[model samples]
Target: MHLVHLTASTLFGGPERQMLGLAEHLPGEYRSSFLTFRENGRCQAFLDEVRQRGFAGEKLRADFPKVRSVLRELTDRLAAMRADVLLTHSYKPNILGRVAARRLGIPVVAVSRGWTWENWKVRQYERLDRLNLRYLDRVVAVSEGQAQKVLAAGVPADRVSVIHNGSRVADFQTPDPGFDTKLHSFFPADTSVSHVVLSAGRLSPEKGFDVLIEAAVHVLRRCPTTGFVHFGEGVERERLEAIIRERGLTGRFVLKGFTTDLDRFLPWSDLVVLPSHTEGLPNVALEASAAGVAVVATAVGGTPEVIADGETGRLVPPGQPEQLADGIAALLADDRTRMAMGRAGRLRMQSRFTFAAQAAAYQKLFASLGSPTVFLQERVTCQQPPSPPSPEDRNAPTRPGRFGSPTSSTT
Candidate 1:
């Protein structure tokens, strides 16, 4: 199978990693390539990674406001590659790729990561994306929670398949010798921070970085030696900076812009935090578990699915700084419990979320596209909930799933 993924990636982030990881782990018969919109020069990072991974990648010259040109380019490229299937990521690709793929009689699948809804402009785009998903041959929701959202948006349930994001555990198995020295370098030379609290995501309003800052104020009051570090950058930087200054967290709370080497530093942190208001199986959470670092994140989206509260990490309500602070502070005070949780988290990732399994799921989905009867059978098979956890693994208290009861698939 010749698979081509179309995306409008402004930076090489989680979704980008998932795409490359799937390609790298898939069976040899499946050839994968990537096509990205030229977001000025920002698409270079992703395209470069694609090349490093020995996959063909192209940056599309035609973009939005030039629908006809984009469709022509897509159709021409798909034909040239003889792509068997076209997979799209994000709103722009979902809207345009569907039309182009239809012109070529190729199956098109849209990977539905939850919307950020960062601003008015993004909200409008997401509205159109929700509408467009119904027409796609398939919609792959990264989380079961997101799959529900897709169903709610009028897409047939049979067309939506839930595939949880996988973690690259091998990347975090070994610690970098100089990671500690490099991490501490970000703080003041005189600062005597004993424990580091780390968080990473796009610095946007929907990510709830402001809520994290508020929680940090309370956490610092109890654990004064804990310093907070955030990775990634976006429009919310200035506002977050102003909030930091106002809270007198000058050097204490730092925003170290986007970095491709986050895995290098992840295992070195004492704890990982994700304060997003929404998510679709966040890679940061999965990566943290792979790094054996306990996370204290908001119970939203697919987070509860990844975080077995009290087993792997604690789950707090979204936008509640006091509760978030309590979770962080309580974990920080007890080193033994936190370390145990981290170990459990790593085991969970190893047993459940792996690229090999994700690749197999995709392979089944791709193979089924050739027959309508097989496709429907595949959908039914993929929708069945996961088997119950083993008795030994059921020690942790189960929290009610935010998006109804958690669902999973053999796929």
Candidate 2:
């Protein structure tokens, strides 16, 4: 099978990382490539990562002013590639990719990472995404909650699939000694022993780093030895920095912008916190679970699916600094409870949420649609169809499906 993946933005985040990871792990028999929008430095960096994994990637500069011409150009390119499926990520590509693929009668699978209505512009994009999703063959939601939202947005329930984001356990299972030493260097010379609280992601408004700052004030008043650190870079950095200064938390709460070495930091953390106001299925929490680090994250999106309330981690209501403070403080105050939760979290990750498991699910989805070299499935049946089937589909028994893929029988 041949697959072409579409991404609107080149910024490296959870969604982008997951797409690249899937491309890397997919079955060798199937050919997969990337179609990226935006040809800037960040996009170039993303291409570098893709090449490192030995995947063919192409970037098209998106000029919104010439959108009609751009879509026509992209549609021509998609026809030339002869890919059986076009899997799209993010709002822009999901909207535009579907439009281009539909002209050729090629199947399009739209990935809904989560609709965070952080601003009017984002909301507008999501509205367009919903409109586009209704036209696409399939919608992959990262969380069940996100799947519900897609259904509510007018997409048929039979057309939405919940595929939880997966992470490599080995990536966070071991800590680099050199990187760990560098992490220690960030601490103040006067501090001999301190409880490290870590949070890492894009420093965006929807991430709720501002709320985390407010919670940090309460945490510091109660526990002075706790050091709070966030590793990410975004437009919210300046605003968060100003809030940290205004709250007089320069020493206690630290912002270490965009560190690629999470293995170093996760090992050193006493506890990890995700104060995001919204999420699909956060990769950070999954990584924390893989590292066996106790997590205190807001009860949002598919977090409840990953975290078993009091079992693996504590979940607090979003935007509640007091409650966020309480959850963090509770985890930090007791080492026994915290370590037990960490162990449970690691066990949960091992049993589920691995990269291999996620890849298998996607491969099944692709196979059920038919081989890329053959005619695509024309029907929109939610279950596996009969007759001149794809090799994988003919050999493997059909499992219950949550979504339908675009299928057209070969004569």
Candidate 3:
């Protein structure tokens, strides 16, 4: 099958990475292409990677001033590709991609990682996207919490699928000695920093880095030897730096910025923290867990689904610095418990959330829609039903998988 992924992304976040992951790991029977609306900065960077990886892709400069022209061009290009299914990620693509696919009578599968709803503009976009969900042939939510939100928005229960985010387990399982050396170089040779607490993601308000910094202050009072290191860059860098200085946490809390090779660095840390105000099902959490690093994250939006409180890791309430600090400190104080949690987390990741497992689920979704190579044929329109199955094929017992049930929960 020929699948076209449409996205308008300004940054390389979990959703963007997940899209690429799917494209890279999808079965050989399927051919994939990427259509990006924005052609600058991170979007361009994503396109560059897509091209380098030998995927068929196009980057269109879709500016607000030339939206009508861009949309026309997008429709023309999508029609020319003759994709059987068009999968869209992000707000702009979800809204615009669905409209264009409908025009071509092509089926659209929209992905909803999570809605930011951080501000009025984001809320408006999310509201519009929620309304647009009704028109999509299928809507995949990363977490059960997100799936619930989609159902609440009046989408048919049968139309939504919950597929958790996954990561490369072996990458995290294999230790890198060179990265350990680099990690040590970041701290002084004869100074404190016994415990490494990592927080990675874009430095945005929705990520709640400020709340983490506040929680760090409290954590330091109890465990001063601990070092809080954050990865990734964003618009809030200056503000976050100011807070670190003003709070006199410049030494304890370190912002490492964006690192392309997370596998090299993530495993060196003692534990991971995700203080996001909201999330769908963060790939970072899965990466951390796969690395055998215990997580302390907010119990919001599918987090509890991943973290079994006091089992795999701790889950604190959102925006609560006190609870966040306590959760971190408690885990840090008990080495045995922390190590056990990390082991449990790794098992969970390997058993339920590997990249291979995720790819298989998506492949099943594509096959259920139609034949694997339906798009390759000229006469077979995307909307047409496949040829009637043989009696034996119809009687084949259906195996249970991620999409076999209405709601599949790992926890």
Top-scoring candidate (TM-score): 1
Which residue pairs in candidate 1 collide? none
lDDT of 3 by residue, 288-342 (tens): 8888889999988888878878888999889999999999999999999999998
lDDT of 1: 0.86
Clashes, model 1: 0
Ranking by TM-score: 1, 2, 3
lDDT of 1 by residue, 184-207 (tens): 778897878888899999988989
Residue lDDT tens for model 2, 1-411:
678998865466677678877877777887888888874546776777777888888887554557897798789878888877999987888888877776666778888878777678888988888766776767887777676667666676556677777766777655766765666567675764378889998877889999999999999878888888888888788999999999988877889988767756787788999998888788888888889899999988777778878988899999999999999988889999999999999888878786676778787666665543333334333223222324453244323233343211100
TM-scores, one per candidate: 0.91, 0.88, 0.87
Candidate 2 Cα lDDT to native: 0.77
| lDDT, candidates in the order shown | 0.86, 0.77, 0.79
- Give the local distance difference test score of model 3: 0.79
Q: Is candidate 1 or candidate 2 better by lDDT?
A: 1
